[model samples]
Target chain A: MNTTTVDREDLRTLVAETLDLDVAEVTDTADFVNELDVDSLMALEVMVVLERRYAVKLDEKRLAEITSLENAHRLLTEALEKKG
Target chain B: MQTTMASGASAEALAVVAMVREVQDHRGPEIPLLLLNCLERLTGAGEADVVIRRPRGRRPTAQLDGRTIYLSVSHSAQMAAATASYRPAGIDIERVREVRNVDGVRAHITGFLPRHADATREPDAHAEVLRAWTRYEATVKALGVGRALVPSEFAGNAEPDITFRGLNLPLNLNTATLHTHRRNQHDSYLLSVAARPTSNVVIHHDSDLGYTPANHERHTS
Candidate 1:
């Protein structure tokens, strides 16, 4: 079991830095594209950074799932659990 | 566009940018329908039986009398926009806000935008850089390669107009039919469009988006 546990704050900060957003703005429900206006490049950058840092493969379809802090945390948790 | 242009019909084409206003939810189905209505108003395709196929997150294609027209849509907050062209088209709209962490060119690939030496000293530098980002983005999306954003290909100074207007500086790729036309609409939003403009591309502003059913009725009548 790869007991790697990623917390919400850590994931939020990672996403915030990647998207260049203020940590407060990347709230639980803010849609990356709709609300924060994060373009595809920004979104892809987050994916690349997360995949590299977490050492997990994120599919393009799953890429759509990581829109906000809440979902991102869930996705990473699921990916980490599966990695084990 | 430092990266090559997307292949389609770029010659002698009719490019149009249409705006939809007061859209409560950009993700709702009504957004596409409203944009389709705008397309109908521009192309007069209402005369023929048209069929449109729009998958989520994909550009919608409409077949009218055996001719295919490409449509690209973008929305921000309460406003939505759709760009149509006989050739491959891509557009993006953004609610312009503060630009941050603009350390340098590579640091802010979307907007390294102090085009000239003294340009960065301007007070509206943040907004200007954000505007530059819009042009760069719309041009890339026009490539039709779906979600392809290459930072190294970005050119801060392309089709440099060097003027600040309702529609500010044009983007890099200036060709016969297609390039990018960007504007600051409502003083708080930025819009950019890329299409084949060989046949006099026409663009409508958000101000005109209030085009109600009566307007359409009068046009068709």
Candidate 2:
């Protein structure tokens, strides 16, 4: 995880946009896989967006742990910290 | 019935393809049924009798007669393909398209460049990138990790540190056998399969799945 903090809303927007859903549909507790129909390929795309936006090399293991919006935000923050 | 390709190092397994003529009506909710339909046709199992198990903390499996069957599936421009064997295997296919994001590649995926400083001289860099991408995806799926794999893992290391279902496994590319198949002279599409070391796989294309609704009905009747 990085030291830089990612705004929860910003992360939600990224997820929503990548998944082609409305931003309002992305909630903190929403499950990306179950609720949004994200398969393995889509998950990879999400990680790419996150890596590009944060400029941080994310641990693939940790990225796989992101099932919900809340977890994604937390993971981004931690990955940024590690980058610094 | 269309094109069929069959070639393998051994007879241990087979990869099969079922043409999906119209995907416009086959998106989202229909994908699972589509896969099952294809599998049923290939395996001679009725759609109701084909058992697909989604075990927690494990790769999904399909079974018949209490025996485990190795399986992997892929979808490309006009095909829904599946591979089955007594040994684990993964397959992937991609329809080549225009490369609009060349700058995106150089910026974000510099890993595509050769280590040599003269990589810019390489022609058709776009197609090469797609080839690498498809191969990487096939490798990951063959490893049973699917999208859990990081793309950069293939960049710096031949052996990737892959963790699946909480188990850290060392993956050695040298030990696995990968076969690449191409369709169309212009390279309009490509297919690749990766399997366990020394395992043999036979691949069948859209025309060879042996799906017969009339024959299946007779068996059930």
Candidate 3:
């Protein structure tokens, strides 16, 4: 399995593509809801993708605390770090 | 007051007590109160900082320390969904009887459902719908975004299995585990609990003081 470092921009692009939203709408500070209009279902979808992409598990309670592109990026990074 | 159990008892072996009060049946904020009571008993803290959301126009409330604990509540069936997480959590219990325009919802939130549309065409279509909806709901609650996130933006490729006519919806996450129970025979209400990856989970029935008679005796003795 390739353990290459996954970049934040890559996650941003993936999220944008998966959700079919404009990439320009997503920013480090953009709220998943306010900016991209992500709902509960969409959030879970992103979660599933992250787990599959990174091969990491996210605690639901911890996932609840994430609210933005930046938050997701940070979490994915932490999960990757733990892997290393 | 520490309730002493039998010597050599491990904390994990100790039964977590839960209190269930059907205050308003389907109307009151009984679940939150039950959770608060359980937390109070479990933690032995008279009152700690807590936040609760209820269905409808109820506002979420919190109290620092008091016999009559304050709870902020709202009425959103969406809030009751459960997701696998590191913490012991609660989910919503509602039986959805119909599918309201899946095509429209799909257009908006395609990522939440499975890729195989045939899976949704079984005799248990209603159950599948509820299962999918609840899984999404539970995930959102676990994530703490509640209804703040739109239904359209959830995205993922893996599809979880739906078993028992919607009794189970696969979470498809590496870290969390999903367990569900159907309380009534008609399957009118579904309760799902999600927690971190653990070998075994003890489901405490609320009315039984969160203990089985066997475990209670084991602890009391």
Best candidate (score: DockQ)? 2
Of models 2 and 3, which has the larger TM-score?
A: 2
Writing each residue's lDDT as its tens digit, candidate 2 over B1-221 gives 53323233434244333323223333454446655665665566776776887666455567877776656666554444555555566666555444443444433333323444432222365555554455556567677876555665455432222233445433211111112233423324444555554443434334423322211101111
TM-score of 1: 0.59
TM-score, chain B only, every model? 0.64, 0.57, 0.47
Task: Please state the error at residue B26 of candidate 2 in Å.
Answer: 6.8
Instruction: Encode model 3's per-residue lDDT on B130-214: one tens digit a residue.
Output: 4456555544443445555544446543343222223433222111112223253222333332222221223333332222111
- Give a tens-digit lDDT track for model 1, residues B1-221: 01122222324345453443456766787677766775786577673467777777666878776787777776655667676656676666655454443333224353324444433222365555554555555665566655443443353432433222223333222211111223544435555555543323444544433221111101111
Runs in model 1 lying further than 4 Å from the true structure: A1-6, A13-84, B1-12, B104-106, B110-123, B155-157, B160-187, B197-199, B206-221
Could you tell which candidate, 2 or 3, scores higher by DockQ?
Answer: 2
Model 1 Cα interface RMS deviation (Å): 6.4
Which model scores highest in TM-score? 2
What does TM-score give for chain A of every model? 0.86, 0.88, 0.83
lDDT of 3 at B116: 61
Candidate 3: misplaced stretches above 4 Å?
Answer: A1-84, B1-29, B44-90, B106-110, B114-123, B157-187, B198-202, B206-221
Q: Write the per-residue lDDT of candidate 1 for residues A1-84, one digit (tens) a residue.
A: 345588678788888887777999988889987888776545655766777778886654565566777887778778888878
